[model samples]
Target: MVEIKFNGQRYAYWQQVHISASVDDLAASVTLAVTRPGTGQRLGVDANTVIEVLIEGTVVTTIRPDSIRRHVDANSHSIDIEARSLGRELIDCQYSQTLSGLSLDEIVKRLCSTFNVPVQVTAKAAVVPDFSLQCESPANALINAARAANLLLYATPDGGLLLTEPSSAAPVATLVYGEHIESYTVVDEYKLRYSDYLVKGYDYRNDLALKGAVKDSGITFFRPLHIMADKTGQGVGGCDRRATTERNRRQARANRIDLEVVGWTHAGGVWDINSQVRVIIPDEDIDGVYLIGDRAFTLDDQRGSMTRLSVMKREAFLGDPAPGKAKRGAKHKAKSQDERLIYATDLE
Candidate 1:
């Protein structure tokens, strides 16, 4: 059973509800409809009202209403409410700054502190120099900073933030193609795959230009042509190890396929974002393990209840590759001291 609390009050007049949660975007949302109150009563909920949804005695999400709508007909009246998880707060808050010589953990911790938000970190990350950016919002800045170190930052339902590596848990459930699956769709997205990457960075102290490239020969000739360029920030050391680490991270992310499958199973509270599961499709000769990236749970009078899952290959979330010890003796010529007083050119 599902229950809802609106503004510290309990309500039980909902006719139907739909909930969607995802790890890829780090967000959860709900849409619910309730019958209008009788003769002398009025609905007391409005946009931005806080709401908590519980399923089977467990809190599913703590959200705020994004929109509210009312409908009136000859026989009855009803109101519809839509809400999103607390992570929306981060998106709503804007922040700007340039951080130098800070670890990924420190940067996220400071950002959360500035916003008075709660945070929990479970994994370790490398320290780099000079992360500078003007983001559209605080949430964007946090996400981009984390991604640079191959980490993920997402919000919990109870208004807390989680920074960690992707989970490596065992499968919670299994689904067979002709047995439990109602429908399924597979997307190869071959064009997005890349076989080689060219990474470039500069070491200001040594006045040296660093360039590195990596190629994966695993891909057959049928799809052989692909390359990408990457620019590393100032803090990344100008060494082969750093460039190799960046290349491996990029390749792993690009080696993915998009898949969505619908099944008639009670996976609502049992399965969640970042969980691993086994998917078997005998007819298509496809049977492999995958990570649940997104999920949608729906309940109604006619359709009863069903679960839909969006999944990706498990290798996509592997840990970052190691960056070996820095190289020595690399040097370059410095600019002449006599040219120190260069003047800026003005445009006419």
Candidate 2:
């Protein structure tokens, strides 16, 4: 069950609820609709009210409402509330800071503290010689810095920031078609893919030029993409890592698997982002391990309770070695044996 608490009140019932979390975004988003006064005897929920959300007696996120709408009819009264995690402050606020010789975690902690957003660093990274932020969004700065360090920076479920790398552990669970999966979609997008990815940079301090290049074996054509390494990624090693990251991200996204499963909890715990899961769908020939990049817990009259999962190849965020060449053989062979089918319902 889902619970929303505000001003020391617990609202155990809701007409509709949708909560979305993703590795690519810095804040988790929530939309709730309910009849009656969920906020005690109050007529309506106040703007910018701090709310704590819990699922199955476990704290998930603390959110502040960005919008609240009320509706009344002849027999029914309801309110729709939209909220986001406290980490939204980092995305919405501008910050200016200049620091030298600090690690990625230190830079993130400093910026996050300015907005009173708590931070946790789970990965260790090298120190950047210099860093600067000129009235920029802290979210962007943190994201770029983490990318340079080959890490990820996203909002935690508890309304704080987390800096970490993708998990290399075992799959949390296996999702099988016709069992746990309610629906599925396989998307093949070539627009984002390129035959060659070239990353170029210059290290001003060392007066040296750096270059890194990688190819998309699937593209086969002569399409190429050129990228300029940012200030953080200014060295030869940094440029190479950036190039590999770009290619892996594009390839993973170019072919995505979206699934809708019944209920919210897996065997071990609640559905989570940045975790790995094994997928088995014989007809689609998609029997492989994947990374859960996005998750959404949704409930309504039509769909009582369900979770939406968007998964990509594990190498997308892990930055694994030479991504996909050695592991995709069996899956590729199976895919070649059959023509792909269009899941029309997924479009809507």
Which candidate leads the pack in lDDT?
A: 2
Question: When superposed on Cα atoms, how far off is each prediction in RMSD?
Answer: 6.7, 10.7
User: Looking at model 1, which ten-residue stretch has the lowest summed lDDT?
Assistant: 339-348
How do the residues 53-144 of candidate 1 rate in per-residue lDDT, one tens digit apiece? 87665677777788877877666678787887767766775555667678777877877777666678887766756554454466655554
**Residue 106 CA error for candidate 2 (Å)?**
1.3
lDDT value, candidate 1, whole model: 0.59
Candidate 2 colliding pairs: none
TM-score of 2: 0.85
Candidate 1: misplaced stretches above 4 Å? 12-16, 35-43, 46-48, 194-268, 300-302, 324-348
lDDT of 2 by residue, 1-348 (tens): 889887888887777989998887789999988886334334345765778888887777888888888777666677787899989988887766777787778877887888888789898777766666666676766665566556777778778888888877789999999998989999889898999987655544544455677788988889998865555543113656667777777777888999999999988889888889999999998899888988999999898989999999766864434222111111221122222211101000
Say which candidate scores most in TM-score. 2
